[model samples]
Target: MHRKTIVDVGTDHGLLAIGLALTGKFQKVIGVDVSQQALENGALSLLSQIESRRKGIDPQKAALDVPVEFRHGDGLKALEEGEADIVCMAGMGVSTLLQILEQDHDALTSDLNRRQYTDLILQPTNSKPRNLMFLYKSLQDSGWELRNERIVKLSSRWYVTSHFTRPQSNIPVTALIEDGAMKIPGSTLDCTLSDSDPMRQDLEEYCRHHSQWIRKDSEYGRMDLLEEVWLERFGNDR
Candidate 1:
């Protein structure tokens, strides 16, 4: 796989950065944290490991360089525009994450156009399904599309990671559906869909059948209320 520039926002310990660097998955890796102590500790921990690795190499041998750096800052403020090809914001609350995006919207927009950022990885701290819906709509309005999503079930919570990209002229219809909606081709309700994988056809059929009950009792007034709430919260900026 081709190496890409990667930035991890709210990186508490910098383990992700270290792992990516050591694995050579990223040409450059940056770990950003708001806490100075956390940045220092993470940097020290990574440096110690690098030093340990160097000891095993011959004095005359050139060591494999580690491609990572640690920085202390609020969100992407410390990063230069167009610096990273993949931006990751993990282990943060939905509102906090939204605030970060709102604060750096202009910079991010410029970078997205200039560098053509291929991926945005978001891992929310809590299972806020409504927040996720809000985020999805926000991204869509901002000219971005959800590329992929995964819900990892842990002992206590589900870690939801969503990957997004700038929207293109023609997106596959299968990718336009939201979760828990009808998946039928001619259905009124949209289900979580994707065109990249053909094997998901059965899943689409299942969603179509499952959403029949919801469509029967669904209230248009309730949906309007939800839309109003989202608008009040997110505003026209999204």
Candidate 2:
């Protein structure tokens, strides 16, 4: 979450990567997309942005300090383990998001796991609840930790965004909340949203709306698994 190198996966037009580079928040920004044309366009856009900032300047050679690259590949295949401090996936389908995260295991070299520094920032464009549930379950199962979640409404549609990091046993989930420290039986995890989390109201509404969809056979029932998961991850009795 702090200053670090960034890998923008599923990058469309590379706008976000470019923007971050312009802000100088990251030391490097690598934009990855499945489409070659998209990467080309993004590169051009990045160049144009730089040129616009300094007229009659060579954007590529300009002393912007931050290095930017565009790569063509599916999911995280374009990146090596520990190559990035933060991996961002935005405006992607739930299935694709899941697939990308699943593929991430391939990049977990020993050094990367040891540092536990790589972070994931995901924004799914569809299947919000299902995606949240999948992500929650996946994190718990894979020993990754959910650091934050928020809902954002744009153009009358809401998108759920989450941040995660490789598991750290030191930060118990119960430590995040003021009075919600009911211990999970099998794990020592605790999680809570900030009072100013953008979608706090919407999240509560979602948990209430999906209350009807709880199926007995479902792993987490009809409730938003995000809520069920906090308990499941750090609450369940072993």
Candidate 3:
């Protein structure tokens, strides 16, 4: 419930933006999409939500104080510099997400009004090693530091939601790649295997799946670094 301004990139039907606005947490929620029809649909959906609230159809009690706006554009094209303190991109492939982040980097470096620190929330639908590695390297390269991450299992599929921030420049891309490939220590692995924390358990499952998928695909480059990232977060010694 932070009073931050959020811009949802590739916001199809505006569900995320509208939902956030309904929470009365953000100062503004802007849904940006490439399609006009999606914007129209999202507007209608938001209107319906507002109508429901007016009629007391929905009972939660949090008044919708945030203003939700919809813009039509690709990636960050619809957003002006410094307009949003947070940017969210979800339900898209890693490649598309990378493109959007790259564009944001370019904009940030070029624009005078771009904020010094803008949070990036990403949910990449695909779990390829190459994709994951690319995301990792790209974030560091673009000056965004990985602050937190979570893995969720849904419908027998694994999805990762990562939170990043534009912190001070970090390790080199090659070093990051190496970090992700580093193997988890045996002791750390044992601890995570038996940890009762749900997030830790989900991470263990995510590692198992990610390791298997990457190995099956013969994407050997990221194996060690990926495991290293896991250990860095959940390892007993860290």
Question: What does candidate 3's lDDT look like per residue over 57-164, in tens digits?
Answer: 546543444378888888676776677888888999988887776565554333312553378888888854446656766666555666666666789777777777
> What ranking of all candidate models by lDDT puts the best one first?
3, 2, 1
TM-score of structure candidate 3: 0.74
Model 1 C-alpha lDDT per residue in residues 1-238, reported as the tens digit of each score:
7778988888878887777777877888888888999877776576666756676674542334777788888877777877888878888887888778767556434535665566788887854434555666556545565666654445645565778776553333324443322112112112344555442443344333324422433444334333333333333221
User: Quick one: RMSD of model 3?
Assistant: 5.4
Instruction: Write candidate 2's Cα lDDT for 65-145 as tens digits.
Output: 546777899866777766778878888886777677666555333333643447878787873445555555555444566
TM-score of each: 0.66, 0.68, 0.74
Best by TM-score: 3
Q: List the residue pairs that clash in candidate 3.
A: 179-225, 180-224, 180-225, 180-226, 181-224, 181-225, 181-226, 182-224, 182-225
Q: Against the true structure, candidate 1 has what lDDT?
A: 0.61
Task: List the RMSD of every prediction in angstroms.
Answer: 8.5, 6.9, 5.4
The lowest-lDDT stretch of 10 consecutive residues in candidate 2 is 182-191
Ranking by TM-score: 3, 2, 1
